[model samples]
Target: MSARTFLRIAVSNTLVKNIARYVMMMLLALLLFGIILLATGKDPFQSYRDMFGATFGSAYGFSEVLVAMIPMLITALAVALPSRVGLINVGGEGQLYIGAAFATWGALTFKDQPAWVLLPLMALLGMIGGALWAFIPGYLKSIGLVNETITTLLMNSIAPKIVGFLIFGFWHSPMDTVKTENFVSAARLPTFFNTRVHLGFVIALVLLALFWIIMKYTRWGLEMRAIGGNPQAARRNGIPLKGYLIVIMCLGGAIAGLAGMSHVSGFYGVLILNFSMGLGFMGFLICWLAGGDPIGIFLMSFVVAIITTGGNFLQLTQGLPYAVINILLALALFVVLASPKFFEGKKA
Candidate 1:
């Protein structure tokens, strides 16, 4: 085949594979919902229908779901980039928090600056802070002294404590609550409406476009994809493995940092204990489930977000346990895990 033909074929194959994977995921979700109904002795069809309808039935619910998806898009990008370069970035939570804390600091300290300067500065500093935060593990891995996962996870533990110290020791807002500090007006992001949605969603969308383009068209992306397919072969083919790893780690940190800014500047507008919470891990889950497909990231993030929103709705309206909704999602993940080869055989 000609090079153009090969490229077309590859793209065609990828589209088919992605579609098959999503179909299997949906089928698995149905099966699990049925199993849940059987186990709980509840009407599975009704429960499933209510759960799904709760996510999509109202404008408020739909908006809430999309708002929740914003962070995952950012974090998924962070995880997916490093993932493509064959590196695991477990430090996204830590990187995100630290970036938020520092961005909050910058926003407060530079209160006199205009938005044009302050916004870019905060984002840049956030990116730098997160990159440095993840760099330790990346450096250690590059030099052959330690595994990145352990080090990255350790950093995750360390991040909240550092934030705690800042809240208690310094940077504490005058509010009676000692647990979190509020950010100033210039520090917080402007919302799209009276709703909690922020410009960060747009930021994430732009990032999705950028990442997709990079992965699809760039030489660096080609190298990363080749390396991800098989590092040993990539190394043999003259890809600088360590350099790519460092790049991946740093970019991953920047992506996480962007997520951090979204929280501080958009959601909470404060430095709080474990503020980032499960978002980073959630992003990784999206990345894993989507296999670095940008469009898939966009769709699956919203789907997961809808489930989360619906879970909250169930809690508020039906007195359903939050744990039950989580269990449903977990079951879905398990189903996907149990059938890795389910999507591989699709030819179209």
Candidate 2:
């Protein structure tokens, strides 16, 4: 075959294989969740039915899922961006915290400013906060021979405490309510429906297109793919390995920062330590389940968002414990992680 034809075939084959693998992983996860429910003396099918009804059966319920989608989707983007450069940033939680902290401070600091200036400025601060958090570990990996995983994870532990400190020390609102004060209207994301869902959903969708273009069409994206796929080869080909690494880490951090900002400004409007609540981990899971395709990330995030919505319904409507939802998710990720090895048999 001609070179162009061969390239097309190769890309097509990769897409098909990834899709098949994703489907198998999802099926296995469902089976595992079912097994867990059985062991717990509950009806798996009934629980799943209840969950499904919450996400699809009612407008109010479905809308809540959309509201939840903003942060999870953004966090997934954060993790996926780092993975593009072959780094495991398990510190998404920390980056998220710092981002939210900066965003809250920015909005409050400039509450008197117009939305056009204040909003973008806060978002900028958030991205910068996230990048700064990621940059330290990226630097260590690039020059100091330190392990990125350990440094990143350590940061995660420190970030929440910082948030708590701010809450009790300086951020405690002057208002009667105990929580942080509501953010200025300038910082809030505009919503579409009367529901809590906001424009961050639009931002996530726009980002998918932007991600594809940046990764495939831009010089920077090519460098990231090169380093991620084969750093040694990239270096041999005269790519600036350190430059690419820094750029990739910064982009990843910035995206994650935006995630924290989205959660606070768009959803919570305050810097709550509970603002994280495992969202960083959820983002990591979404990236894995998406097979690193942006569109796939969007779709998988929506599904998980639905599952979360369903989990809430199970607790509220059916008197099921909320922990059951997490148990199901853990089961799902475990099954998925095991499937590639199980399906490694040679095709006939």
Candidate 3:
């Protein structure tokens, strides 16, 4: 056979296999979800209808879904970027909390400043906070051979405790709430068309586009991908592994910090304990589902947002437990990890 013909055949087979794998994963997840519903004496079809209707049936529902997608998109990029350099960054949760705290501090300290000044200042502080939190893990990994996953996860636990202490002690209001005072008007992110959908949504989209370009065309991105593919080869090529690891990890943390700031500035306008609501972890799943493709991350983040928004309807109307939504998400991750056979081409 000719070389060109063999190459074409190989590419076609690979494409077909990938398509089959994705379809199988989806089908398996749905099947498992249906089984759970049946075991609980509920109709899966009706539940699905309710879920979809609540998320997409009205403009308002769709708007809420978009609101939910903003932070997910940013935080997903946090995970995806570092993953390209063969690093697992699980500390987005901690980074996010610290980011929010720093942003809140800026807002409170500069309450009388103009929007142009205060907003940017808050964002910078948030990024710095997140990057610092991420840097510790990166530095330890580079210097002491510590596992980034464990350090980052441990940081996640520590960040909330710090926030709790601040809100419950120093920043606490006499109103008996564990949340800080509301941010000034100038500190709040602007909305689009006077809707609840804030500027953070647009920011997430811009970051997605920016990262896509960087990953596809930039030299740095190429180096990161090479390192991910083979560390020994990257080292042989004279790539500075330690420097790249720390830089990429810090960049990821900065993105997650932006997510935290967005949540406070655009959604809550106040710093509260546990305000993240597991969005950082959801971002991890988004990265896994997207396979580290920026565009795929954008699309999958929205899909997860739909599920989250729909889950609220499941609770309010159908009286279903919120755990059902968690089960659905877990099933999705399971199927993606378990269905590799569909991606395998026929052997000779």
Best by lDDT: 3
Please provide, for model 2 over 265-308, each residue's C-alpha lDDT reduced to its tens digit, 9 standing for 90 to 100: 88887776566888887888777766566776777777778767
Model 3, 1-348: lDDT tens digits are: 589986896688666666566667767877898899889888888888888898889888889899989989999888988988888998889999999999999998899999999999999999998999999999998775799999999999999999999888888666856888888899999987656899999888899898878876899878888888887799799999889889989988988998999999999998988888788888987786777676567767776787778888888877888867888777877876664343242100
Off by over 4 Å in 2: 1-35, 38-45, 175-178, 341-348
Off by over 4 Å in 1: 1-24, 27-50, 177-179, 229-239, 342-348
Output candidate 2 Cα RMSD: 4.3
Worst ten in a row by lDDT for model 2: 339-348
**Could you tell which candidate, 1 or 3, scores higher by TM-score?**
3
What is the model-wide C-alpha lDDT for candidate 1? 0.79
CA-lDDT, candidates in order: 0.79, 0.79, 0.84
Off by over 4 Å in 3: 1-24, 340-348
Clashing pairs in 2: none
- Is 1 or 3 the stronger prediction by lDDT? 3
**Candidates sorted by lDDT, descending order?**
3, 2, 1
Candidate 1: deviation at residue 168, Å?
Answer: 2.0
Q: What lDDT does candidate 3 reach at residue 52?
A: 84
Q: What TM-score does model 2 achieve against the real structure?
A: 0.87
